[model samples]
Target chain A: MKKFLAITLVLALVVLGVAAKVKPIKLGAVLPLGDITGRQAANAMKLAVKEINAAGGVLGRPLELIIVDDEMNPSKGAAAIDKLATIDKVDFFIGGMSSGVHLAQIPILKKYQKITVWIGAASHLCEKALAGADWYFHLHPWDYQQGAGYAIGWKQILEKYPQVKFDRVFLAYEEGAFGTASYKAYLAMLEQAKQGEGPYVGLVKEFKGESFKSAAFGGGDYRAVLRLAKEWNPDAFIWAGYDADALPMMAQAKEIGFAPPIFIGAPPGWPADFGKSPLSEGVVLYGMWAPSLNKVSPVAEHFYNAYVKEFGEEPATYFAPLGYTNVYFLVEGIKKAGTLEKEALIKALEQVEYESPLGETLKIAPSAVIKHQGFTTQKILQWQNGKQEVIWPFEVQTAEFIYPFPKWEGR
Target chain B: MKKLGMLIILAVVALGFLFPLYAGPYPLHVMTTVLTYMALGLSWDMMLRTGQLSFGTAGFFGLGSYAALLTTLYLGLNPLASIFVGGVFAAIVAFALGYAILRLREIYFAITTLALAGVFTVVARNLHDFTGGPEGKILPSAIFNGDPTKVYWLTFSVALGSILVSELFQRTRIRFAITAIRNDEITAKSSGIDIFKYLLFVFVITSAIQGVVGGAYAQQYGFVSPESAFSTNFLLLPIAMCLAGGIYSTLGPVIGSVILGVLSEYLKLRFPYGHLIIYGVIIVAIVLFMPHGILGMLKKIAQKTRTEVGGNENEK
Candidate 1:
């Protein structure tokens, strides 16, 4: 019995030694693992980490990815970040698909002063104002870029039908930082241009809580917005929200015969999976990137090919590209820094500039605001039949923008 | 014997409230949450004493949260006052429901209460015009003023108040009625006890306590969402804690909530993926080995020692 006890102690000590030796650079990826957005981002991120480690890796150290599930709740998101920083002791953090979850994580990130590279959130206002150290960065485009790109696509729609001039354009958006910023930017650009100059989409609606209607803002239900659209006879309608909020309202809009001449939405439900619904045709939506577009760079071409080969389908959306690019950016920064120390890495991030697959060389600023050099560019896409096609930035145009979607005779 | 037990419990309660002044914020937060469940568990026990088992604490908790939030939003009332109003709202709802459904005993009552929680969730979601729906609302930090320690102390004070009231009720003649009702309701009724009246009284009182504590939870966190407030995590953890510590007794719930609460938090960090499994194993171990709960086991051990001493005395 004594001999057996001695052997057990020796085994335990050996196990402890093994555990002590198994150290890798721990990097955290916070995502809504149990939610839909996380489904895409989480798998893509794990794949990115696997590929990175298979290669020589950064600074001669293998990368270890620690994933924390936020379960799509903001409080959970915040708590996950806190756990990652305090308990997991990670070197840096990345991954978020929802703006709400993303917003919830910012204060914690700022408090920890850990390098946080955003994957898919496009809340420009929040991203620009995040505090802590010079570590917060975003690979996604801001609302200004998305809204401006949509506007450029809208101009294409108007060019197709000269007689399609209308009096007003109304805006409906989710009441959050991302939607609010995007709506304001879109309105400013529309008002500045003489397009709908007399009665430019002056009406703005923001909804809060579970109410189908905005009681405080004189908006009630989707029916109210639909009726107002028909009465005012707007040339187009813009929705600045996510798929969760927009898809239902869009379905209702189609049912009401209020399919405006031009329909544009923010990234949430753009090119939404309309399935058999005919209303989805000719709907122009703005996003940070579209993997459908064939870029000129060999590196992007390789990534696009590898993604399809590995994932068994064409990258469904630009989210995969954002994850891929962000990972690549992190690798480049680590390589440039030459040390794993936070200060050294922050200096390297501030100094280094590199061209990404998105066709821009991102340069970091040392200020608290997360800024990258280069004009924000997004490829415009329109839903045709079952697939989304790149239609704008004529240089990369895959198909001509389908204007006045062939009226569904079935309706 | 009951008086001595009350005195000892009061002393412990006083210590529990004073604990926050020395504890760190993290410990304080865990303690505060434990106290919240303590209030919840005791109220649950109060109802159990009268032979009613409610699985719908989440419903009253959710209602209380929404009430506090709505009161704050619509009326801009102070946080403390809103909490009282929220608790009253829950009691009123419980009273109305108790009138109709308290007649059913055992599983029927338990199942109905559980289902009602689902109904409350649907109502909250449908009322998204007021409630935030699935998304919920963010509470302003101005209420708690950004101090976690202060919040912990506040929660501790509220928890002590809840425990005191529960102990007070447990010693009253109503307690005797509740005990008599639990053992044999038909006999108790024949002996001049109003079974329905007593059940309703306990139900309303316990539901009110749960509602107020839940309101305190919302105010403390500065955020309340339908899913979190009505979450199974909040509901089941308390029940499990009560069971693990020893059910149907005040000490049992207190001991169970603290041990399980702290253990769960620790395991969550150690093994995020399998923490719930770890929690389950610990709970099962305690239940299987100590059916009478920790308090009851201690009593048995103490009695065995007393008999052993008496045996030794006789031999001498």
Candidate 2:
């Protein structure tokens, strides 16, 4: 009995040792899984992973996902990437929701020299790689492109509000790199447009002493900030921020009677399915491609159908498309690279030019912006009645822009 | 006896300093955050020493982080200078607020501090002029420049410095006055101890320490949002660590931080959202089973053993 037991123990030890040596394809998912954006990104990624594994997996080896929670924090996001790279021994990383989180992980990703496929970082600066980081690949549309789309919509609103002829546009953005860059782009564009346009001055206000560099709300109530805006009496309020902030700010602005003719917001809160917040209607939101609306491409139908069949909900927001496009393109890159090896994967990713569910074929760029395709730009959507409708980039117009907010008379 | 204790502590400190070098990335990150909590816990105890319970450590922490983040982002200040500036800002704010609120005793003091933290959070969220509001701020890469190992070293050094400062305060006449105040504030005041001055001094100094640690933490983590900085987790964990380690003593916070910090990491990994429950259970059990704390229990055991040995020697 002792001899048999010893043999069994030896067999178990050998099996355990062999199991440890069997290296699986390690793919890391760095997400804000506990928060709203993270939850959506994680769920979408899980769905993609499930579909991939079912479809014979990547490189004949089952793909394993090691998700690290960024907790919607930039430092945590970087730390999550560090853990994924050093501890999990992942081959590559894919995920990000909050722009702050993405910007935080950029330097770390650069240091580690890992191929990171950004799922939802709208910051054009991160996409540009001012520091010249090549390993970082952004799958989502750049906010600058979205800002331009917003400018197009703003052009119409400005024309509509010609009678209101006012100066000073208040720019309130999140203090991260993404928000700062977007704000700069928006400000520059507005400045050029508002040039010599009669008392049309601009007052860029952030909190006292601290500039809008580090995502501080600048140290006062949104109502107080709005009151300051009321004091300034800007022609409009151009807020480039995510859902977590925009909803409450709008509520507070309404409370304090700072109703501008236009209130424009960015991705996180601008989705048509922003069901959680009561301030869902009337605010003009700019987001990346929503699978439900961006059905111009044939791939959208297949993706939309598959997503609905699997998840039991329509793909109303960009979460599904972002996840689907990232995984689909990543897998395509893996296939093109011809191996699951890191260098091969990166090489393949660089060579990628595949049609995504969002209708555009994503091409990897030699420049910092990894995905170089025409569709890798943002679109403007407005919350009319109860749902978001694509209004800008007139070519793909699902709906027309509702001119003048609050007392908006025309659609 | 002091020399022996110092030498033993030196060895432990060296180990604490060196472990990050050999540890895996995950463990190193956990240890870094542990050091952050250790600094927070010690500072909290220092304030409590003056018989003032502050619920605004998170507020000061949030403010310090913003100060560091803002300086680094806009002014392009050096990392060390940013941390110092953040600490100074927090200390000044604490000094002003402590003067106004320190007159109230016990729960009022606690509630007032809690209200102060809420005000800071509200300001952080809505102001949108300085802070990013709900989106939070992204710290610049210039601080430690994305080197996790270097950041770990920074945290260790800061934690050590905070501990030494706390020890110095403990051994001072100020500490004796604080003790007298905690035991009997009226008597402490009657004995020529200006209660308000000491209270404000302790509050400001402790807030400065928390701010420094908070600044270091913000840079180390590379992001600061109102929610993450002012989260109840930050406030609760440090208090739990100080109380569990045996509050009012230097060793208690240090030891408590080590245990709870490690346990919090493990629980977070295993249970994710459910770990808070496990954390509450462990804390409740510890508070119930050993009211004086593990260290105090160990001292009692040692004294009893020594007494038994002396009696045995007499019998022999």
Candidate 3:
């Protein structure tokens, strides 16, 4: 019996030794995690990691994905980055669900020299990178692109869908850094058009009839302001804000029965079945990488199919594709580098061209004005007949922009 | 007993100074956070002793962070100099504000401090050009030089300084005045404790410490947004640490900080999902079992052990 116990202990030690010998490569993700979007990102990453392991993990070892919740705050995000860099000693870091979180991780990334990928669209995040450093890469449309995309779509409506007739519009945007930057960019684009400073503006605004009024509101107490805006009854009510400000305003718009011809702007509630809500009918949102887009790549289709199969439903948030793409990008970079070394991975990341859900052959250009991210094919999606459809960027548009939105009562 | 306590504290400080020797950069980073929170706990205890339940840790913390960032951005001072500037800024603000707001007793004072926190958030958001508004500011990369170990030592010193301040406060006549007020304000006022003056003094000291802690936080993290700097974690964690360890004592906050800090890191690693819920449950258990705190429970255990030993001796 004593010999039996001794052999069992030795066997257990041997198993432990073998397990320790097979060190898994860790992929660390920093996200808000509490929010639905953040949770979806985590879930999607988990699915990708599972598939990668099943297919025989990287470097003959299983992959371990560690998620740290930044809670959308920069300081916490920085702390999370520190843990990933130092404690967990993760081989690669993928994050930047928010621009602030991404920005916070920059200094630490410099310290660790770990290859970092940012998926947030905060325009200035990567732009602030030191001129020569090439260790970091970014994906996702910058706020400038998002703003410009909406403007171009609006221009398309102005020229093509003359029946919509958007003369006098009302713009309501949250007064945070994001909303302010995007709104200012939009205004500058319009002002450039007003002066014919840019080539596309004069041809688009034929009558200078593009008159609009705008108001900046705080994050809280949107109902009263929305009611006041409702009283004005403009041609279109364009609201640009985050989920917090946008969600409340959307619910209150339903309460006040303030439906305009075009309800267009940034995402508030989300890709999360906003179409199913009676209040969200005909509302358009500016976003990056929608599944509803027409120019779908085979890689994107495979991702969507896998996502639906694993999640048992279509992704409620657009983050699933983003999360999946981030993993694949890192995996592809590693494969190209032919080693797990940070410098090699970073060099490969710079030259990486992968089939992302957003674009075919999605590539990153290091240290330009756009700074590490370039993909012009962002999608502006609208809810039409209880389904979200891509409506902008003429080549990949799945459906026409539904202007002259049906009234809340009628819907 | 007092000598033993001091010896333990000194030994801990000495070991803390040597923490980076063995711990990796990640552990050092987490230790820096633990020290920052421990300092916050000590500072919070200072105010609680003055018979005020101030909920303005986040306010002063955010204020200090902005003050340091603006001073460095505009004045081009060293980060260390900026930390002092932040502390001075917080002290001046607290001294002036306490004159008006310190008169309110108990719940009113608590509510006022809570409102002041909201005021800080709005002010930070509005000061776009200076504070970088909601996005906040990241210290220039030159500021930190990317040394987590050095930052950990700096935070350890700041945290140790806060404990020393708490110890010094307890030793002074100010402690007697504050203790009297905490026990019974009207009686203490009758005994000429000068309630407002004592409260204001404690408020200034605590605010200054909190400001320095915030500056240290911004320096270490290298970034601070209005939301991150003014995070309720600054308010909640320190308060929880103080209460869980044992309020109105120097070692309580220290013990509490270490326990909670380690537990929090462990939970963050082990249970990322609903960890907040798990954390809440642990706090509830601590409050229930160790009503006075961990120190109180320790004291009880010590006394019980002594009794059991004496009883055994007598039986023999």
Candidate 4:
């Protein structure tokens, strides 16, 4: 009789344990794994998943991330979404990079209506496409938001240092989607500034933009544009192009003696070792997060260290931290919801506030089109002594601002 | 043997038509992509049958995409009607462009056609108010509201149409004319064939087919951008597929599209991090080892086996 009772009790315990085990919550990510941004972002997501699983997982269920490479093609990106939604049946959709690819994916994503948290695609057109998608959360700023952020950053910098002035601005944009969009946004802002309404009202008095064929597109000679900039002699000179044009553009500008009071290169990503180049110094640019932020924020430090330790390389792009935050933010929402119910999870997500490694508190807000926008402001940073140091956002300042850009003669 | 080949072709078409019944959205999406590329490859092969290495597939494709999207946006035309509009627009453009470009042959023609995409992209980029400029245009919704089965069937019809057109080219007097032209253009002209007219006709037809496919793709995806619409992948991938499957035939590109398409998806899944390098290497290997393509190699083997059998009978 005693042996029989013990066996029954053990069996019951085993049954309960088996019943308690739950299937993992799957996340489907479509990214261009060929690019540095996508590769690092994918790796960072894996790290976050590992960390979350180790911390007892979300809602007592482990997270499973299924990543597909988009190959940087729009059709491939859309097809990847179909695969994830139909074949994998992922509970959520995440990961994005290019706006064009994301634009193609929007229809497919709309079909599934899955809760999507994307970390890239800054184009305002994407925001417009995703206008009514309450389930979609965008972590990257829209182009207009980035433009506004820069206007504000410049405004603040001018206030901080009255000695510095940026009354005239010249934009040398590449003749592509990214550069053209940037030029258009700047033009809009400039018009607003002239009317004394937008963020740049008190900062920029005159703005001129000219298009150049980007070196990335096989047109490298910037002598014409550089000569134009030199003749205009603007207070601030900025070029919106690709990383391929960085060194060559700088060389041409140097050759033509086109130094301005403030020079900014607003490429998506800089070439490796660009900071080591002397030309990179005193060049103000825009970005979401930098390794220098690791010094100021403990969250940034943790992410940077763990990323380096796990991947055996430093996080090269801001997308890495953004990817990590993407997973954690969703997981936190899942934990709050206590289930994968769509409505409940969205509510939980909207209420959740994450101290992101990007040195900002990420919260859900409204943009011009979308309901959920994150990280609206980008930090203004300058390359100083082989390091990107934040100069704006005085609360997270990593270094002092350099006064006029250095002359070409003295190195 | 010919009846058996015909039956096999009919069976394949039947299966393709019925594929959406058993397949899920993912496979359907992949097949839609395959069919799009198959149509493109067939059109390219059709042009190649004329012995002109045309590189304007992407240009016409972009032109069709823009036409379809713009008509839908501005003219408020039905999306289905817009696809035909795309084809008609491409045909008219090709007819006009063909008159000047067909005069050149070989590398000069190829290079000029290759530049067509660049020229169109610049024009598209500059036309801000009409075309949305570099930002491009997007439809309010995808065709059929993003129904996978419907999209698959639409693309299947286009591909089937392409196959029929290719067969028509093969069976009709157009075949002899194109063959003679490919063999010796001067001889073909002297043999009472209007070489220029034939070339222009083939070019316009193929460009129309490309335009239709591109229109279908844009409508299915519900957007058109200068970069995406005029992407070189439209030109290069079809060429690669045609080369790998055996050029200048209807069956070759079909076989190539299936094999390469499925292999590419499989490789991407199996090796996400290093798939492209592996895929490129495999393509290079296939091109290097099988210069005549898989179909050509198979034909050669069959011919050799038959010859051996005849020799054995003679010995007996």
lDDT (Cα atoms) of all candidates against the true structure: 0.67, 0.71, 0.75, 0.92
Give the Cα error of residue A151 in candidate 3, in Å.
2.2
Write candidate 4's Cα lDDT for A226-291 as tens digits. Answer: 899889999999999999999999888888888898999999998988988898889988998999
- Pitting candidate 3 against candidate 4, the one with the higher TM-score is 4
TM-score of 1: 0.65
Q: Candidate 4 — number of clashing residue pairs? A: 0
The DockQ figures for the candidates are 0.08, 0.24, 0.38, 0.84
* TM-score, cand. 4 vs. native: 0.98
- Tell me the docking grade of candidate 2: acceptable
After superposition, which runs of candidate 2 have C-alpha atoms over 4 Å from their true positions?
A: A1-22, A123-130, A153-186, A195-267, A270-284, A289-291, A294-298, A308-317, A339-347, A364-376, A382-411, B1-8, B62-78, B81-140, B218-236, B272-316
Find the number of clashing residue pairs for candidate 1.
Answer: 5
Per-model TM-score on C-alpha atoms = 0.65, 0.75, 0.89, 0.98
Q: In candidate 3, what are the lDDT values of residues A253-283, reduced to their tens digit? A: 8777877777875643463555676767788
lDDT at B74, model 4: 90
User: If you score just chain A, what TM-score does every candidate get?
Assistant: 0.74, 0.69, 0.79, 0.96
Which is the winner by TM-score between candidate 1 and candidate 4?
4
Best by TM-score: 4
lDDT of 3 by residue, B74-167 (tens): 7887888888888899889999999989979889999999877678877887776777666666666625676777788788889989988999
The clash number for model 3 is 0
